[model samples]
Target: MNVLSENNSITETAILVNPNLGHPRFLEIDQKLKKKKFQTCLLFISDKRDPAYIRDYLNDRIKIVPILDYKWQSQLLLERERKEKKGFLTKVKHFFKRKKKQISELLSQKKIEKTQRRLESLKSRVYRGSPIFPSILEVRSVLTHSIHDLEYINNEYCIPQDYLIKNHAFETLDVFYEIKIEFTLADELLDLFRIRNFIMFDIVQEKNGITERINYHSLVVSKNNWHDFTFVQATDLHLAQRNDRIYGIIKEWMDTFKIENLELIEEAYKKDQKTKKREEQAELFKLPLKRRFVNPNNQFRIFIKLMNRKVFRNELEFVVLSGDLIDFTLLSKLPKDIKKYVDFDYDFSNWKIFKKIVLNFPQKKRRGVIKGEELLCPIFTILGNHDYRPYHYDIRWAGLYRKLGLKLEEALAVNDKLLALPISAIVKSKRALRAYWSQVNPLNDFSIKLGNNNFIFLNTGSDSFKNFLDLITGHPSLTGLTTKQIIYLQNLASHKIQQKKENSFLFLHGPPINPKGKRSFLKRLSKKISGKIITKLDEFKESVIKKIGIKKDTRIDGKFNVKTGTVSTNWSSLIEFCKNYCNLTLAGHTHSLKEFRLDDPKGLKTRVFNAPPFSLKKVENPAAVYYDVYSEIYTSAKDIEKAGPFVVQTPALGLGGYRNPDLAGAYREIVIKEDKLDSFKVKFIDR
Candidate 1:
C-alpha cells in the first residue's frame, strides 16, 4: 500500500533490520505493510554493535535492501583502511606520476636554474621525512594490523582451536550468517532519503533470546522541513581567572615580560617570594588588558543574549566553538622563589574557575524565555593550543634537551578535563544540546550525525609539534591535523559521499590550510629571520651553560609568550584531505576573520571559513583586520557566493583595540542547503 502525497509518494517501505534477533513484528510487516518485495532502505539502530557489524550480520535477512551504516566505529576503521592502502610506494608513485609531465616540460625548456630547482623539489618530496607524515603512516600501519589480527584471531583461534565453536556449530547459526548488502545507495532511494526522513526504530528481546517486538518512532523531518539551515559559530573565548590572585600574578608577568620594566618585575618577583607578601604580589597583577580578561559569568550572559536574538533563537540548531575556550597556559612548576609564595594546594584554582564557567552555563536562567525555546542549541568544541598548553610544563632549554619525553598521559588528562567539563554541562543542560559525545576519541576527535549531514571534529592540537622548538615563543605555532585524524576524516568523507551523498564538514581549533596568496612576503621573511636568530641564541646559551656544569634559572623561557595563529608550515595531507573529503572546513585559531576558496586539481571545491575570536582583544595578524571591515563585509556574502567556492574569516566577539583603531567583534550566520553551501553573512556585534 502506498501513502500518496502531492510532493512525495511513499511507495518504498524502509526495513529496520534487527541484527541482534529477528523482531516478531518483522513477520507482521512483511505479511501486511506493503504489496511488493521488501527492497528499498535498510536502517539499523543499534547501540550494542557497530553499523558495519550489524549490516554484515543481517545481510541475509534483509537480502536486497540498501543499508545505511550510522555506526561511528565502522566509519573510523574504514578510513584507517583507506589510509593504509596509500603506502610509501603508492605516495611516491603518485607524486612522480603527477609531476612527470611538469618535469618533462621543464626539461624541454632547458632552463637550468628552474629545471634544477624542480628536480630538487621532486627529490625533497620523496626523501624529506616530515614530522607529521611518519606518525600518520605508523597509525595507519597499526590500524591495518589490528583489523587483520581481529579477523585472524576470530578465524584461527575461535573456529579450529575453541571447543565451543567445534562442538556447537555456533558459527553456522543464522545470526552469524554473512549477509550481502549494498554499500552504496540506489539513485532513486538516495533522491527519496534526500528529503530528510529519518525513520528511527529499536529491537527488543527477552533474556532467553526470543524476539519480543520492534518499536518504531515517527520519521524525524529535517529542521521542521525548512529549506534554510542556520548556525552560529564563535571561538577563542579565552576566559581566565578574574578578581583572583593568580590573574594578578600572571598579568604582572605578562605586562613586564617584553618591556624595560625589569626593575618593577624584580620587585614583584621578590615580593612574591615572601609568603606574607602574597596579597601585595596579587595586587601587582592588576593591568588594563581588557581584551585578555573575560569573566566567564559575563561571557555566559553574552552567549545567552546572543542566542536570545530572534535570528539565532528562532532557528539556530547548533553552535560550533572552534577552539581556545580558555586563555590560561599551564605552567609546569613555578620558580622556587615564586613557589614559596604560592600555596601548593591552590594550584588548581584556574581549573576550578574553568569548571565553574562550563558547569554553571546550563543553569535555569532567571530570564523567562529565550527566543521561543527555553533551551539553547547544542554547542560542539575542539581543543585549541591554549587549552592544553597550560597543562604542559614550562621546560627550560636545559631541561628540554636532557629529556626528549612526551607527557602523553598528562596531556590526556588535560584533554579529558577540557572536554569533560563542557560535556558534563551539556548533559545537565538537557534543554540546550541534544547530542552526546559517545563516540569521541581520547584526543576528543569525533564524528556527529545531525539530520542528514555529518560533522567531524578534529583535535588539531594533538601531535602538533615534533620538537621543543615548536613549544618555544615566536616559533610558528600553527599546526596541522594528526595523521590518524586525517585518515579517519578522509574515510568518513568517502563513506558519506559515496553512500549517502550527504554534506560533510570538518571542524578544528587550528586552521589546517591557510588562504591561498594571502601572506605578506616581507613580514614572513622578517619573522623567519628573527625566529632563527632567537632559536640559535637559545641553543648557544644552553650549550655554554651545560659545558660550565651550571644549572641555570631558565624559568622565564621565551616560549611562554606568543601571539596565536601564525602558520609556519603547510601540511600536505591536510591540503589533500580538504581537496578530497571536506565540502566545508571551519577553523578559528588565528583570531582573525577571513575566507578563501581552495582550488583543487581534482575539481573538488572546499570552502574554508576561519572564525574570529570569541573574546580575544587583539588579533594575531593585524593586517587581516580592516578599519571598516563591518561596512566592507556587508556585501561579502553575495560577492563571495559569486566567486564560486570560498573561505571566510570572521571577527572576534569581545574587546578589540588593534592597529587600525577599530573594534573587531563579529559572529557568522551560515546557511547550508542540502550538502552545498547556500550563503553566509558576518553578523558584527558591538563589544
Candidate 2:
C-alpha cells in the first residue's frame, strides 16, 4: 500500500510488516515497549494463544474494527512448517537455500512496508511516550584485582574511566574508590627504629581522564588512631638528584660506598636537635652555626645520615619531601666525561654510590624532593618538575623510588591501610594540565601520614605549566589539571570531604588560585562563557598560548592552554576537604608569598594555610610547615574563609639552620608543645 505523508526532512521513509510472522512476536513487542517506560495497547491476533484470563476480555481493552483474510500469513506459515519438518540434513539444506531465501525476501519487503505503514500510521498516531527495555541487564564481571608484577596495562582504551552510572535500578558492578600507590622500599631493606608516619594522596579522575586514572592518595589514619596520631610531611626541599644526576644508579643502590661522611653530617644536623639543650650551654663555646650559621658539609651529612639510618630503622611513619633537597640536575647541562670519571671506578657499590651522591650533593642551590619511609613523623613530599625531572613528558621511571631498595621503607613508613593495596594496584598521583600527553594511571601516587593529622602529597604539574594551570586554575593551584580533570575534582570534592573523620592537611607544589581576584581579568575583558561550554570555545586555538584569564592586557594569574576552554572552573571539590580538615595546604611552586582562606559564615572552623616560598627564586613557599597534631579542627567553609592569613612564615631547615627565617620564629617545637596540641599550638623542633 502507498501512503503519502508530510515529513520533517527531505529523506525517504518506509515501514514494512510480515503478516505471516509468529504471532507471539506481538506480545514480545508489547513487553519491550513497556520496558522502555512506555504504555501500549494490546492488539491480539484472533488465531494466537491468549491467556485464559485475558481471552474472555480480549475484546475489552483495545478497539477492533474488522477482520482480515489469512492469505499472506497462510503462505508464510506453510513455508515455516516445511522448513521445520524436513529431515536433519534436508532441514539444514532447506534452511540455507529455499528457507533462507524466503525469510530474507520477506524481511526486506517487511522493512519497506513497515516504514511506509508507520508514515501512513502517523495520521492516526497518538502521542504515546517512553519505551521499555528488557527486564534483565547483561552480566558484567566485577573488577578483578590484578597483580603488580604482571607488566602495565597497555590497552589504554580497555580501562574505562566511568561506567554508565547505575540509575535508580541497581545491578552488580565493581565499585571502588580508585587510588594510587607508591612503593619505595624493599623487603630485604627494612629500615626501622625511628619516628615516622604516613602521608596519603586522595586523587580523583575526571570523565575525560577516566581512561587516565586519577591519583587520590589519602593519609591512611588507622580508624583506631584517627584521634591519636603523629606523622611528618615534606615539600620544596629537593632531597637530591635522581639516578641520572648521580653517576652510578641502577635498579638498586645509590652511592659509590657507605662512608662516615654521613656520620659527620648527622652530628652537625643534631645541632638543630640540641637547640633547646644548647640554651643551657655557654653562649660563646657552642659551635659554628647560631649566627647566620651555614654548614653545607654538616647539613648535607645530616640528611644523608637520615636516609642511611632509615635503611635499617622502620619505626618512624610517613615521609614526604616536597622538593629542592638537592641540586643534582647535571650540575651543568654539559655532558660528563665518562672516560675521565671511569678511570677510577672506586669499585663503588650501589649503596656507596647512593651515599656519595647524597653526601656530596649540592643543597645550597639545587632543589629536589625525597618522599619515602617516615622518620620521627610521616612525610609527604609535594614535588615540582624540578623535584624529579618533570615526567610531564615521559613515564620511564614512574615508580623510581618504589623499585629501589625502599621496599621496606614503603612497607614500614606507610600505614598498613594503603600498603595493603593489591600488589597489582599502582596509581599515578601525577596529573598533567596540558593536553600534550600524560601517563597518570591508577598505579602511581604519593602518600605521607602523621598523628591524627594526615598530609597527602600530589605530584601534579606540567611542562607548559602556565597553560596547564590555565586548564586547571583557569579552574590551577598546587596542581595543574585539564578540563575533564576539573570534573574529576568536582566528583572528588564529594568524596575527599566524606573520608575525613578528623584534621587533615594538604601537601602540594602549587598555591591555591582560588576564584578570587585571579579570575577577575578573565571575567572582564574577554567574553564570558558558561563553565560548561568553556571546553569547546575557540579560545584554546594557540600553542604555548593561554585562552582566558586575560583582560585588557592584564593577564590573570594563570592561563589556559591546549584544550583549556573546556575545563570546569571550580575548587568546590576541596571545599569539603577544607571544611572537614584542619588542613594546612603548604605550597612553594609559584615562588610568590601569599595566603588566604575560603570558609563558611562562622569564623572559627577549618584552617587553610599556604607556605610562602623560601625565596621567590626557583622554589617558592620555603618555610617548613609544622602541624600541631593534637588541636587542629575544622569549621564551616565560611569559617575557613574568615580564618585570615593566620600565623604563618617559618624559617627553612637548611645547612646551618633555616635561612631567610620568617619574621616569626619556628611555629612551635613538637617535643615541647606536646601538651599544647589541643590548643592548636604547633611547634617545630630543630632536631
Let me know the TM-score candidate 2 reaches against the reference structure. 0.33
Q: Best-fitting candidate, measured by lDDT?
A: 1
Please report, as a residue range, the 10-residue window in candidate 1 with the lowest summed lDDT.
Answer: 133-142
Give the CA lDDT, 0 to 100, for residue 193 in model 1.
33
The whole-model C-alpha lDDT of candidate 2 against the native structure comes to: 0.27
lDDT of 1 by residue, 1-687 (tens): 111101111111112221211111111111122322221122222222343455433332321122122221122222333446323233233334556555445434234345333332221110101111000001000011111123422221111112212222122211221222222223433232322222112222111232222211111112233234677776655544421222333344446455555456646555655565444423433433343333333444356345534322235645666666554433233343453343211223243333333323232232211221111233556665655433333222222211111122222322332321322211111111000111110124545454456666766652234322433432234454445555565556544444235555667767643332222354334433223422322332333434545443211112112222433223445555554555556766555655544443333222222222222232222111111122234344344334333334454443222311132345666676644456566665444
**Compared with the true structure, what per-residue lDDT tens digits does model 2 show for residues 641-673?**
334222211223331121122211112211102
Clashes of each: 15, 161
Clashes of 1: 15
